[model samples]
Target: MLEYLPILYSIFLVISLCSSIILLIPKVSLNYVRIHIGVLTLPPLVALLALIFHVDNIIWGPLHFNTLTWLMAVFVLTVGLIVQRFSVHFLVGDRSYRQYFSLLTLTTAAGSLAWLSDDLRLLLICWGTTLLGLTLTIRLKKEWQVAKKAASTMGRYFTISWFVLLAAILWLTQTTGYWQLSQVMTQDSLALLETWEKTCINLLLVISVLIPAGQWPFQRWILDSAVAPTPISAVMHAGIVNAGGILLTLFAPLFNGSIAQIPLLILASVSVLIGTGIMFVQVDYKRQLVGSTIAQMGFMLIQCALGAYIAAIIHAVLHGLFKSTLFLQAGSALHHDQPLKKSKKPASFIGKFSGIMFGILAAIGFWAASPEDAYQLISAIILGFSVSFAWMQLIVFGHGRIGRISGLILFIAGALVYGLVHTGFHHLLHETIGTGAQPSIPAFLCLMFILFIGSAIGLWLSRNRTSRGFTILYLWLVQLGEPNQAAVESHPKYLTQYMSQGGKKDEFSINIK
Candidate 1:
């Protein structure tokens, strides 16, 4: 019965994809399609539960029904289902409403299929289809020239990433003599190739993943993508940008201990800092969220670099759920009608001292738990730093003694929740996801120490408003976080063209508002 889940999951997704095509029919009942897609999405989530109990990984035809693949399949489809359901009402009467749902569902289903597939050929086809579907979905609001420009920019990046991935896949299969990804990535197959060959292929794979994850040098697309509708932004952030972590986890064996990991680490680390700057500097709500995503993705990739594949997957899943919710609630972020109140400011001298002390203790405790592991050392620094930040922001800075106490309690509870969630995912995925090649301790410790000092110095400098370097850095971040000129509009010039072209009533109704 457990073995049959792969077949059943595929059937459910296939049926959903085909049914979405029916949604493209103008006369079809959109609500009916909504129910159909939503209902179909639930089965995969259920399938995930069953896979949790089934310890052995099953290769049912093209799919390797491991917990990792099944979990991701459930995640992507769940995000798609949410986005589609939200769009059903949110985008009503707008032009291309039906088309949006169809393409979204197509993209989601194809993405699920790609992961479930073990055959390299099937993965390529489904992966390509997913990209195409997303590209088209981004263009759904074609009447908006800005949206079209965003879609065009996205398409170009997707093409480049896809090609790089294709090249890597072809090279791997040709060298290993196996079209099956499960086989091609195995230690025996990897040993068949020379060291240089594996490194080159891994490098190519890294390049491909970076492009889609919105890492530095390739992140302009995500900033430009703010011109898209909120739901589109949600799906892009939630499902598509997670590709880097997913792909990296899948190919962790090939990536582990490769020299390529060093470059990936460097690039991703830079992206994290840059993304942090962008998030802080950006005024636009959507762009702020975009920056946050870039930062989050960088962290995910960083986890992958350290051979913590399962942890990276956990990050991707949580980030998707949290980021998608933020995007969907973007409109609510700025409540213009709400009264601006000046609240009592907290006494922060004591708070800052307390926070710093707590942070140091937390860092030491975390490091003690995994003193020998390079990745865990980094993780400890991050966790401790995060706890300190949260402690200061929530408890130390609370309005009064009572408020501070409440916040302190809440903070502890939140920590416990995080620990539980992390532990659960670790146990669940440990069997299917292998730990990749461990990184060198001396290199990571030295690198982290330098980075920590640099960050401290940078923060101190940033506080000096009169410094030329500070001003230049601030402006650079603001500019980087800004949307492209093509994606910006003083007015909907398309409105005039749309009206002139005699666009339909319903479309005009939404546009005129």
Candidate 2:
């Protein structure tokens, strides 16, 4: 019975691909395609429920259906459903609608294959297929030069990422003689390798994950990909790009307690700061969203680096849901955004002290929710920072008693959700795919200190942005982050005409292009 579960989604993918090909017929119509997509979503949802109900790995041949893989399957199918549904209405008049749907289904299938495979070589192949699907999707609108540039840039990066992952897989197979991920992860292969070889392999895997995730130097590709259709954007942000977190989480055994963790941590931290800094300066909504995603990916990587693989997976899933919805609803900004408020001075000493108390509560909540054996440093620092940031913002920036109370309630609620979800995922992964041990205490403490210092600096800057010294720094960040004015000015006349008529290019603001 358990062995059969692995083939269920494979059957669905075949049905979907056949349906997609059939729909390409001019007389077939899109109503059937929409219904097929809805049906396609059921297998993953059912598989996820089965996994939740039965706490055991389902391994049949080269397929592995674990808690993490099932969860990823659900995510991929959900994204496919949403994107296909959106396309039903969004691409009603587009000439390449059939091509888009075909690629969408293919991409979803590839993603499923990547997550569900127990074989490292098969995972690499699936991942590469997924990347190819994304590149085609990005270039869906062949006439759009910006889309072409974005797709070209992403293609180059994807190629590099593919090679890196391929190299990592080859090295792993050669070193351990194990093609099965389950077997490979169980052995301490790193211990058997030389220091240089270990570092090289880990670094390759890190870049392979982070580059596709739109971190730092590679972020521009994603930001530029805004020219792709909104449906593509929905799937890209929601399903495809989030694969990096899943990749790192799936390979937690590679880095947990290893020397490679520190470099990955530093890379993640830098991405978090720089990506978030750019978000603050971007006036364009899509650019801001891209920046936000970069920061979000960085944060997820940080969790992975800290031996908090469960937290990273949860973050990726949640972020995917939110970002997909946002992309789908990008045209209706009037309904979602709140009016901006003016900045104010920092909180008084008494208010600051209150924040400290809230921070303490946050720490307690996180500690209580996590497994007893889990790493303490991450939970402590996250709880402390959440409390401090919440307290400061609520006390100083919040409008009144009601605002402060609401803020506190939200923080408490968030902490509870964080704790419960993290615990569930952690337990699930522990049973299905064993995680790495916690980093050394001293290393954990160092991370905590660094994060808190960053929080402190952010607090100070928020309180005194009007000061000339800090103002200069803020201006520089804005200048560095803002989209090029010349590029915006050079928007093609034909593209603008198409956009004005409500074409597939959903982002239409004059400032953003």
Candidate 3:
């Protein structure tokens, strides 16, 4: 029975892909959408069953089934269902609706295959397929010039990452004498490994992951991709973009106790600061959401760098769920009345100090809960940020004691969840998937202190509101992401261009206030 899990998973993927292709039968009734949903449901259901059955490390041919693979499979399938249903209403009259479903399922299948493949070579191929499927989906609005440019820009960035990934895989296979993902970890001769080889492999893998995750320098591509339809944006944010963190987690064995993590940590930290800073200044709604995602991904990578793999996975899953819902509901916010413009006073020093204290307490709670030998600094800092964000919600936005109580309960619950997940999943993953890392305490503390100070300065700036130097610095960062006027002029009038070319106006077109 256990031996059949991999085959069953493969069969389900095939059926999903075939059903999607069948949808492309010219003039297929819209009723087929329901059938397509049913088909898409099978794989995730199987994945859930496998999880329930405690199936792990089931490798047949090139495919692999482990806790991580099945868990991610379930997430991918759930998101696919939501996207499919959302599309049924959103693209009701579009001529290319069937094509959109086709590509969507194909993308899901590719992503699942990548997640499940045990062979590095097979994994790389699935990665390319996933990228291709996403490229097609992004260009669903063929007549929209902005969408075209977004696809082109994403393609360029993906191409660079793809080549780097390919190179890393090839080099790792040669250096470790292993083509199977499971075998690479057995090469225990790290001390004997050449310095250059280790650095090259780790650097290649980090760059490969960071670019797609929308880390600092590469984030503009994702923000610019707001031109794509909301459904595409939903999947892009919720599913495809998670490849980076997943890749990092998948290669945890390689990153543990290595200098490779140092550069990755630095880059991820910068992305977190810059992404959050830019998000505060964005006037456009979708761009702001994208900026938020960049920051969230950075936070996840930081967890990975700190050897908190389970916490990182939890972050990714939660981020995907909330971010997708946010993207789907974004248009509704525009329909509502905007708040009246008004000047506001900065937060009081006491209130600011209280928030900081709450944040520090949360950080300490997480650090104490973390595995004794594992890196705790990054985890602590991330917890601190999480608590500070909740404080902002309670004190900055919520009204009175009830809100404060709610925030307190939430902070405590989050701390408990982090502790449980870190301990339970750490053991479960180590037992089932064989990925665990323990980095140096001194190095981890150094990184943690830097982040803590940065958060303190950020909090101070928010409260002061009168710091001319910080204000100027913030504005300059925002301008880095601002669209160039000349570039906007170079493109055809956005939706108007499509109308002039004999295309009908989309009823679902998003309206920006």
Clashing pairs in 2: none
TM-score of 1: 0.94
Global lDDT of model 1? 0.83
Ranking by TM-score: 1, 3, 2
Residues 1-513, candidate 2: write the lDDT tens digits.
Answer: 655666766777778778778877777755666666766776666667657676348787777877778888888887887788778767765667778888888898889889989988889888999999999987877776667677888899899999999998898778877899888776575456667776778788898988899886677677777667888988888887888878877777776676777766776776777778888888777777777888889888877877767777888888999998988888886544686757786678888877788788767765776546445546665667767886687544677888778877877687688668777767766665555577765556556666677767888988897888678878876775654442343665656777687645422121211
Off-target runs (Cα >4 Å) in candidate 1 are 339-349, 441-450, 497-513
Q: Name the better of 1 and 2 by TM-score.
A: 1
Q: Report the lDDT of model 2 for residue 280.
A: 87
List lDDT for all candidates, in order. Answer: 0.83, 0.76, 0.78
lDDT of 3: 0.78
Q: What TM-score do all the candidates reach, one by one?
A: 0.94, 0.86, 0.87
Candidate 1 lDDT tens digits, 305-340: 888888899999999999999989887899888899
Window of ten residues with lowest summed lDDT in model 3: 504-513
What are the per-residue Cα lDDT tens digits for candidate 3 across 1-513? 866876887898899998998888866666877888888888888888887787987778887788888888988878977888888878776657778889988887888789888899889998898888888888776666667777888888899999999999888888777788877766573444577887888899999999889897888678777767788889889988777778878888777777877777888888888888878888888888888888889888877877767767877887898899998998885755677755645676777787889889878876787447455645566568768767766665455688767866776687688668666666656665454567666557656766777788888888878889678868887886565332243555754655676865653242212
- Quick one: RMSD of model 2? 4.8
After superposition, candidate 2 runs with Cα above 4 Å error: 1-3, 188-192, 335-352, 364-375, 391-415, 440-453, 466-472, 483-490, 496-513
Give the CA lDDT, 0 to 100, for residue 334 in model 2: 57
